[model samples]
Target chain A: MNKRKVYIFLGFSFAYLAGMFSSDIKSYFIKEVYSTEYGNLVFKCDQAMREHFIAKQVVAAKPNAEHASSLMQAEIALIDCQDYDLARKKLLSFGLNEYDLIELSLRAIEEKSEDIRKVVEIHEIRYD
Target chain B: MKFDTIKPFLCALAVWFVFAYTYEAAYAGLRDNTLIDAGKHFIYSTSLTPIDPNIKKASLGSKLFEDVRLSFNGKMSCALCHIDKFGSSDGLRNSIGIGGEGEGSERLDSDGLVVPRNSLPLWGRGESDFQTFFWDGKVEKEGGKVRSQFGDYAPSNDPLTVAIHLPFVEIREMVNDDYEVKSSLKTESVKSAEKIYDRLLERVKENQEYVSAFDELYFLKLDEIEFIHIADAIKVFIQSKFRLQKTRFEKYVKQESVLSPDEVAGGLIFFGKGKCVSCHSGRHFTDFKYHSIPFVQAGFGKNGFGVDYGRFNVTHDPDDLYKFRTPPLTNVEKTAPYGHSGSALTMEEAVIYHFDPLRLISTENMTPLERSEFYKKLLASSEDSELIPYLDDDEVDTLILFLKTLSYEESSE
Candidate 1:
């Protein structure tokens, strides 16, 4: 081939190679960072923070016996640290796996936690 | 004139004719009377009964609506879930009841009982021809006979009055679901509800303000005050406060106001191609019928395990599975997070869910069980959803604009 023809052919080959391995080439240059440590810490912190907050709110609000019992049940479900056998049975009955149970429990806890915070706020307002 | 000489002028005239015809055809819904005529067939003026509520009774009812003393827990009231800021809704996905504290999102922070259903707004409720109540139509009137959980011993023949009787006796609403309440009250029986009413009446009678007001309004002595009287007073207050006010759409229909081009286009889509008029027909913008739209179920459902049977819970019919009453659209703009589960956060999403529910679903995030539940809902969806013609993004936006026209004037409210 002539010099111009050789250059043109080389350009096309280079373009084809780039197109073929673009994603892999990009991945080599740009690495995705994922910190399992940070994720695990966040998860643990959230669980602990919620539990402590719920405990403090319950004490401060001085909710009635019935409300206290109900709160206890919700807090138990929310924390998900204990009562594995109960959780497993409930999940089985609902035809759900552990992940689904965790999701549902967290959602229920979020709602309950919201309510607990409101009660504490009300108590503060009334006393203050 | 030579053929070449006349050709340019003839061509120009032809172009002008085509342009005019295209423009007219594109805007025919606005320029002509056909769209308005078609809209008239579906919509009518809100037929509100003129109510002159007795000052004393309505005042008492207003007080009672806010009074926590009516609840067994002394923490909940009708005002807690039905606030003015949310246009009579609590601004939560599911209403926090009995053990809940504060108002709106503030209630979410408390350990309050989650009601598992979105709070229905009070606008245009108990108005003329508005017969159904609740998302499941649990309290309804058919063939002039009021039907409710009360069965044969319905407290009042009036549907709204019977509906008013519910929250006061409902578990997790006003009454605590403790062993004492459950054992003493039998919770589900008519006798138990009657007993609870008597207890509430006694509490109301203890307050001198309520007693005097009841005496003035009903000519009943403090001892003679019944639970029915309380319901009637609250009904009067609701009727007076939340009655349907005239909307921009009403004014447009009455020839008092002119809608913008976008609004007109939206109105055309809503009544014509959107097929929204099928379920959202009549004066109050509801046929008061049940429909299943297959919206994403959020939180633990009414039947538990993230599955709500909706109207099937009431009728126990297989056809009624996943069906819910068509909610009245009055003040709909203010009541955000729509649907029976309050899953759709905006008006656009709610409207989109009606025809394109799967478009909003994230299949990657869903578990096997959730996917199975969604499949069941998809199967149970109404055939009416199929009737809606495909709308482009602009058409959907315009349709939302038309919905805004249905909003009552801020000053009027």
Candidate 2:
């Protein structure tokens, strides 16, 4: 292929990829925020079980070693409502809040990708 | 040929960008608007938040409520019964309406007929969850449409009726003698009502304060004010007055120092096994749903009068008979005598009434009220053991202490 033609093709491909992944990237940030929030509302009604759900969503959405450690810490804090401070600390470390998390969970409904779709289901059921 | 082909491609991209930006902006604006519009319904749709954010609708609705000339008698407005300071209801068993000659529940002529049902207190009815109106939950449809007694459901595209409490005015006593009487969608009584209604509607149109407020909130002209619009404005005012945030129970939980030893015990009973929290959950202290208990009827002393029969009457479901909406206990102290009939005179009696409710309790042994035929019947009923379980006197006192805590928080704004 000609050098100019090759560069143009690559540029167009990059832009299409950016456009396609925009919503997913947004969803990842949203899921993290809402999982933290659903944690808070559920914590009000029940702390231990809510923490379990919270940890599950966190691990599923961001399956890195750091998040896995935070997920474990959230589970430990679930023993009491006063332990909300501990849960808040984990959520803050991830840069998310309850309202942001709720909006993210709602935003996930618009995503059509299967991999993203699976993660959204786990987050939503845990949310409910 | 080369220029023509390039020009079409460039133009397509430009159009796509423009269309995409516009679509996104419109979608976002619509979402925010939905939240704002539905937020009113979440609280109470009574007050309108002005689109301009400068004009206040509650203040305007308040002014309209205080205007006496808005009535057929040219003397009574909403404020006559719902005096602001007096808990938004006259402290009468029933309120004098239209012609204000005697006390509520007194022998007053209404088209020569006496009024039925007590003047229910006005607190908490402004809460968005409260769609049921009158002593009976008779006016609201599933979609929040106004289904009047003689009129068809207002059109769906129309605004929701502002005030859900209009059925209170349809009683014969509230209407004038000369008001034209109609049987179908026609009649002289209906015509006269339509005229007075139009007069009230005209007053709203003429008042610069209301015209300005409604315009600011709805973005519509004064001449465009529909009955639903007025109702919405009035509803906003009513709800703004009584937000029902907390009660003594919540206070005790927050301010541990205020709780007495008995209140603490009652608190355990309330949340642990007393099962009150099952129905009385949330900050408003009610699930805002209905339940049936065996409590004997009170109020107007008419059978099935105070009994709600729950969503069944609204849906005609047989399982819902005698089921009434669980009353929020925010201002329960002021909205007595309790239950659908004003049956229980004191909180203790209300508790005792809830204990068994199958047998009648005597009013004499339980608490003191002015003696009347209704009072006499209650006095006789209060003594029945089947109606009230023999609580060790301390248990009774503790429960009452817990209940008093369910009032609006003293420190609340």
Candidate 3:
């Protein structure tokens, strides 16, 4: 095999691999940032709506009116996720009405409320 | 020199050349085909998104607007009330819902009932500035950003406070409820209203046509069938199709509208001395803010008496009393009798109210107040006439011509 040919084959392989991995890589980065934002908002909202952010399993075990409110706050914090529709369902099965769902989501976006970076990280870990 | 060496080299070269040519040709076709496929996929995928270029959503929006099921009764579509011919009011003083028929005047508080207020025109209400709906600025509220003020108006009877109107509010007690039907008083009894709402969703879901449309564009989760989405979709439809008709005034400003000199002069009076510009600002001709002008409740009173507390009823604030939103003058020529109560029958009649509003300011007023405060400063002493300007009859005719230019009919297509 010629030296130039070896380089050409290598280049083509590299290009193909890059193209295949690009969207996933970009999505990962976006998810990370979004997760950071989501985390911060969840904390603020849990505090604002006076609910605590907890894992889905934990929430499911204690699905009561208070837990529902907490779930709503977390769901709002996670709304910017790519799988927000799914996240919303999981939250609602734990039980949240339409108005509560939307209101909480909007509240999470309020500026200067609290640190959302950690909540966003949690969101990334859960959804990403 | 050797026969073996020469023949072998030639054979090897020929094979190599052939393989290269075949590979190159195959790659060329693959590259072209891949490019085409990618472009097609991009176009198709984008069509499913909200900002799609092909505008499939807009087409769907048009179809939904034509769907009659949106009304409480299957008979009343948005088009029935806000028709093009009738100035968007069904040509009646008040609109009839599920209940019996009545003029706008008759819909006022009678038998301990009222239709709330006259139906607002849909044209240009989709403008971002016009978020709040109804007479009281109740639909989309404006609570300040302060944490304490958040949902400040939450407890109010505004439609936004609760996602759905109470069963009684939705049904039109158009006439005095002589039958004494308890179910009629509540929205819960409106004969399968929820089923109707569900059917609307089912129409979108079950219909093979809509399913394909949704699949092509984007799939909506069944659980997302809240009233807001329904309202948003309808809002989109109205925003997309029923755009306000552009007028000669637009062209005149751009030097494109053909206007006679007299009419042009009259146009200046409208914005300048006539003081129509203060409230009727922006492209669609309204600031979408509330104001109280001294105008009479021509028909019956919704809030009782001539004092129609506009935004006040919604806000329960003293400032908002009699302060209705300034109606956009988009199709003003057609959408009369003007005022919240539809009191003024003609533009001439309406304009005259602006000239001296004290007379019609309130039912108890000794003087007719100017219906439009925008013109009070413009009412020069030189204008001797109580109603229109003291300008020569020719200018008045010109003003009328200019006003005529504001007229626009919706596109038939």
Candidate 4:
């Protein structure tokens, strides 16, 4: 090939490679950032849920003024830190096993958390 | 020129002609005067009255509405939920009540008690003709008799006054469901409400500014002051502040202004094909009747267990199952996360749920129990769902644009 033609061919090759690799690099960076953020959020939510469960149990066992007050405080604190799924689960437990109330609360909680769930799903990464 | 040379030019001319024709047709559709006439007819059919507020009473009520001392927790007020930024709504799917601090997402992220229902906007709430109150119409007037949780001994004959008594006694809304509050209130009964009201009256009496305002407005002595008077003043303020104002749509109907073509198309859909007017008719854009629209349930529902029986809870009638009062649409654009549970995040999603609920929800994500519950709701909604015709994305967009026309020219409060 002539010198000018060879130069043009090389330029096109470089451009193609740059475009392909840049997209892959961007995707990798986004995946890393999203996964890290999501992981931290999940860990915090799990910890909150555990605390909430323990607090609820303590209130149920004691049923005293101090315990009730503590439970109330813990509920607010835990709710702030808990994820949508954990919140839904805790709210469902409030119904005990009343099928009618359970059915209604489940529907309501699902609808309420739909937006948050969608965001979480987007950020969720499956290594498998 | 040769035939070959002229062929390309002819093709270009034909393309241009088609484009121009389509543009003209679209423009003609936008400017169709018949839509204007139809819109006028729909609006004129409803008897709309202009409001005349008692400025002095409303001013006093305004002060009372903003007073945090009214709540048992001393942290909440009427103005907390009914904020100006979210068009008098707290802007969350479920309202953060009593213990909730700050506003909007900040409150959502805070240690607030989630109220398990959307914070309804306050526009046109306590107007003369607006009698029904709450998502369930728990407080209402029929044939001059005001019926509420109070039963026979309703605190006031005025439905708004009766309605105003709820938040103070409500467990999560204004009163913290703590040991002290629970023991003092006993249960959520009329007697309990009266006790809370008495306490609130005493608190208001302590405030010299409020005491003077009440005296000036109602000519009542500090000892003579009652919760009814407080409710009455707040009612007056709500009536004055959130009463319906002339919207762009109203102006268009009156020939004072014009709507763009998209808005006009949306109006037609709302009134005609969409069948939104069936329930959402009248001056306040609500018939003030209960209807089942089968919106996706959100939060912990009214009855608990992720379900809300809506009107059934109030009436205890099988036929009234899953029915809720048709919410008024004045300043609706500002109230995000629409529906009883605040399921729909955007206006488009809200509209879509009316006709195509399944489109917005993922059945795959639902548990068997959730699926069964949804199936029951779907069955209940079938009749009303059939009323709304299918609208394309563009049509839904235009419909939202038309809804925007319903917004007030400026914030009234």
Among all candidates shown, the one with the greatest lDDT: 4
Instruction: Supply every candidate's count of residue pairs whose N, Cα or C atoms clash at under 3 angstroms.
Output: 14, 31, 31, 14
Worst-scoring 10-residue span by lDDT in model 1 chain A: A30-39
Write one digit per residue (lDDT tens) for candidate 2, span B180-273: 4343323434454555567667867877877877788878796788656666666666667665654544433433325555565455444422
Kindly list the per-residue Cα lDDT of model 4 for residues B1-413, writing each as its tens digit.
79999999999999989987896676555444545555554455666576787999999999999999999878899898989989899888999999888888889877888898888888888777889999999999999999899999898898989989888888899988889876777675788888888888899999898888888878999889999999989989998888778899888887798888678767766764565765786788887888777677788888887788888999999887888899889888999989988999999999998888899999899777667778877777775543545666876998899999999876433
lDDT of each: 0.76, 0.52, 0.49, 0.77
Fnat for candidate 4 (0 to 1): 0.00
Give one digit per residue, the lDDT tens place, for model 3 in B335-406.
776777666667766666555554434534323432332233233221323112222234345556657666
- Candidate 4: lDDT of B127? 74
DockQ of 1: 0.01
What is residue B316's positional error in candidate 3, in angstroms? 1.1
What's the candidate order when arranged by decreasing TM-score? 1, 4, 2, 3
Evaluate model 1: give its TM-score: 0.71
Calculate DockQ per candidate and list them. Answer: 0.01, 0.02, 0.01, 0.01
Q: After best superposition, candidate 1 residue B64: deviation in angstroms?
A: 1.4
The global Cα lDDT (0 to 1) of model 1 is 0.76
Docking class of 3: incorrect
lDDT of 1 by residue, A1-128 (tens): 79999999999999999999985565333221212222332343345445446544765687675334333323322322322333345334434444544544454444445677754653454633
By the DockQ metric, which is better: model 1 or model 2?
Answer: 2
How well docked is model 4, in DockQ terms?
0.01
Estimate the TM-score for candidate 4: 0.71
